[model samples]
Target: MIKPTERRVGYGVAMGYGVTDLFGGGAFAIIGTWLLFFYTTYCGLTVLEASSIFAIARVIDAILSPIMGYITDNFGNTWLGRKFGRRRFFLLLSSPLMFLYALLWLTDMNYWYYLGTYLSIELLSAMVLVPWETLAAEMTNRYEERSRLAGVRMIFSQLGGFLAVSVPGLIMQFTGKDNPFTYTLTGLIFSCVFCLAVFTTWRCTWEAKDVQPEHKFKAEVQRSSGLFNHLKYLILDLISSFRIRAFRLHIIIYIASFTAMDVFGAVFTYYVIYCLGKDAAAVSAWSSVGAFAAIPGTYAFMMLLNKLNLTPSSALRLAYSSIFFVLAFLFIVYYTKTPVPDMVFFGLFILNGVARAGLIYIPWNIYSFIPDIDEMVTQQRREGIFAGVMVLTRKSTVAIAILIIGMVLEEAGFVKGNGIQPESALYAIVTLMTLGTAVLLAISFYVTYPFKLTRETHKVLLKEIARRKLGGKAEDCDAPTRLVIKQLTGYEYDEVWGGEATRRVVGQVNCSRVE
Candidate 1:
């Protein structure tokens, strides 16, 4: 049974995670929605140049995420009789760095300075984000609870996106200006929000108890094994993660789904402003509705997951299919001159929001369960490897998707400041790409159905861990199973717990002839 204190700590940790996500997502949305326009129209860079810069930055960040993951997993500090751990340390340090770098947006830099500043800020953001994500998996071991945590974090993340998208419009409306100074003022406001997020995350949460002295000691011992050994271990873990058939399938599906989602998000504002000829106020109104809609949709999906006992694959398939069908219908309506009712459009927007909620929340929740399954197989909790590789995959997809979307726009004759193209063509390109990607995502989701580890299977694995002394005390049983219980059911073990029970729990058994 979990204690009240532990629950409180988890809640606090989740809140910190939410805030961090808010800061990151909000900042990115501001950049994605407006920065491109600023570059092409205001700063006078070609569309290709700006797109190339963004793509290269994302690719570099993708490469860096795994490296950061490795560093965090291996090198951590011991504090207050427990390991302060890599995740929290990096989070604390990077918060301020992220804030400082985000202020780069306010500068009036030429092309070279702009490119360099953007790349530098993006790299720093990834350093903060990669490890921050790993912390979420570390914080809990429960499946349903992980979903709840992810749901909460995602809601805040959307709120961040909402602010990022809506704030610029609000600022422009209030100040009665559309100049560079307006953008600078908006960046300053975002910087303040980033600082607030950092402080809350730093002070509000407790480090997980599992991050203790023994884990730190084990990590140290591994360090002495040399660099080649460490590389070998990483490679083996990567291979083993893929060998799990379900995990491999899940990775593929996640790549497809997330790539589509990221591409859509990056381009959605462009579509609204250029293709629909809508202003910031219209975009903000629709975006707010979409963001708020996700809250109820997320809770509904969670309830559906429980009631239906659906696997991640099943949930994803259902959600993706719904998104595709709705988008397709909307496209047809627009193309056929049927004049889709405003109410119908709003409903579709809500559907899109619901689809997005599931797409974002379920995959991470599923991944949180993978470490336990891996531990059951390898007899080691390699949470870092699992989190790292997943980060690598997701980031790589984002990079590739950005590149692809840029190329697609170039091919479709999308020129900066050309004004909206023929309505039919715009509809054809945007809707076909979005809906096509969704269809592929559905296929990938279906392909992953065979790999899912059901709740029953997970229970068996947990029992196996107990039997093999992977998680609990041999003295607690007389079945010769060699089970090692490191702490009481409701207590967390640390250096301060220096009693005989602790010793026995750590497998200090003596074998001598009976006298």
Candidate 2:
């Protein structure tokens, strides 16, 4: 096992760590953009049936994320955890399993077969993602280094997204666009890509030696031994993450922001094909060009957060505002039925790409620092639990939203693979693409008002945590630092850092007594 170092993270480490998002970003981009379309057109499924497959698989995967997180959190006590690594072990395990992704594109399968394949891939995704997401925190504590890692990761994510859209478009050009085999070939190619990316991440990343203390692990291992007790602790640990004020707010922001995008992605194809009267190839071409716009958008936001030190909330608000404009513009074009030129549509894709980049980038960048906030209240580095909770909320909510979108389209008399949709169906698609996204963005934008996290405040919070760790008296905390601590944790100074107030929280759980 390679020992983690305290040295600064360089470009090599950053690229290695970031590469796995090819799976993270690319796989999902393909699904969100085209999976339902493929299912309806090629697999002979209704809108409701297609969406049910996504919702069911994601809901199950969402439930499992935390369990996987807890296992990795304590896996260090096991031989595999000690030899391979708590987090990277799963990365190594999931690399080859990525081949299962190709099965999803197979045609003429029964509904159960489709459901089973989708569920398997979603579970595999949780296994790979739950642990991998924690590596950014486990790898480095520096805000700058963490930001660098996230920037590179999102860039690769965008690149994966780029390939996800572009490759399909190119493939379909050679092999007829309407052919089901086009999607099958796309899936097979990306499955190989997913396999390689996960393996690369396993090689490139290292977990911090001091992340989990010996005393804490011994206690945790003992507590989680029995089946019933493990279940109890898992539930408590997963729920405990929300107790941190920052984490709760972070989750609200994550769900509201991404769910908006999910709705847009789910409906955008139908809107393009039906509302705009364009072909599938046009959807792919415009989206692929937008993917190009995201690369620079990601880099610009990286500089905003790391160099200019923009507050995350401020950056998010800016991004959401841009997104809202794009949505409104699309609505107008559809509503007015103005015969817009190609350049105008292309311009909208460019703007959407830029806004979506910040939407994707800032929440995750903010997430890397969340455990630091959690550590203050719990005195434990429960990054896995935090990561688990984040994934759980994200997957569950996105699934539900997809389900609702599916239901709405079905209820509106949407027919599978129809070149022409009912007036009702077109109305539903346009409303979902515009009004649905606007509502989510509005909620997310409202939530960002009270969020006060920034680089300077985070630095202060970390310093106080260090002071508490060194056995400094809580009373010694200066006014400004104390306020920063209180604000971030949503607890008064005495109530945190092993204070009696936290005795009921997951951090202070006494597993021996629970039995």
Per TM-score, the best of the predicted structures is: 2
TM-score per prediction, in order, is 0.80, 0.96
lDDT string for model 2 (305-341, tens) is 8888788889999999898888888899888999989
- After superposition, the stretches of candidate 2 with alpha carbons farther than 4 Å from their true spots are 1-5, 210-224, 507-515
For model 1, name the residue pairs that clash.
246-451, 472-484, 472-485, 473-484, 473-485
lDDT of candidate 1 over 8-71, digit per residue (tens): 3355567766687777667776776677766766666766677777778777876666666666
